[model samples]
Target: MEKKCINCSQRFNCRDSYISWLFFIIGLIAAIAIRSVTFLMELGDIYAKIAWYLGVGGFFIFFVYKFRINHRRSRFIKANKLMEKVSGRLELKERDYEWIGSLLCSLSAKKERINYFVIFGLSALALVIAIYMDFVR
Candidate 1:
């Protein structure tokens, strides 16, 4: 009852997938916390509001970028290791690695953009709620 590499049929412990899943959960929690903080904080001054919005937005962007990079790097390493084990060959050229890395980076950027939009949308909704609570009451 041993797990084999999908690429080369070599036997190896399949723990990378589990680790990636763990990281995914942690990333989700971080994202949620970032969103929640921005949603809950009330800024009375215009300058303070501006600073808070920028700070939270910047933090979310940074976290998402780093998270995506780390996640992709871990997956790439795991994939390469599995391929080496199965193929009995380690013929990965620098260009091959670069290509995969770039592809993953671009995909990660796209995902980050989507997340940014969602955060922005949520913030707008929260603003509307705050306004309603302050004036419409």
Candidate 2:
């Protein structure tokens, strides 16, 4: 007898909101570290060194998190033949459709929008500072 799975067809919330918030904070630290390194150098060697370390650590953690997510998603797709199903070579059952929908929801999470806004704002600020430091003053 083939047993039916209960949760396989349901929408799953795979991403943790806390992790998103933590990454947002880490992204801010990285942005500040990179932008302030030159300004901090005028304060002291130790200050600049601290900024550099923060920048390195923040970027390292951020990229590792991103790569882990990507790897997990890719592995899931490959293991489940999701792409083949999408391409019409194979038919996806109800469970597969649910899985793909969940993946799409995960990709379009609101937390990502907030993260992108922060990154864009930081980049714009960095540009303004660079312009003032170099061309204006």
Instruction: Kindly provide the TM-score of model 1 when superposed on the true structure, using C-alpha atoms.
Output: 0.35
Backbone clash count, each prediction separately: 1, 0
Best by TM-score: 2
Q: Assess candidate 1 and give its lDDT.
A: 0.55
In model 1, which runs have C-alpha deviations exceeding 4 angstroms? 1-108
Report model 2's TM-score to 2 decimal places: 0.78
Number of clashes in model 2? 0
Model 1 agreement with the true structure over 1-137: per-residue lDDT tens digits? 86633321121332335544454444444444444443345544554456556555656756675677679777876766745643776677765655455544445443456566766776677577767767886
lDDT of 1 at 51: 51
lDDT of each: 0.55, 0.77
- Cα lDDT tens digits, model 2, 2-116, are 4322332333424356886787689778877876777777789899899989988998898788889889999999999999899976878988977787678678766678777
Off by over 4 Å in 2: 1-17
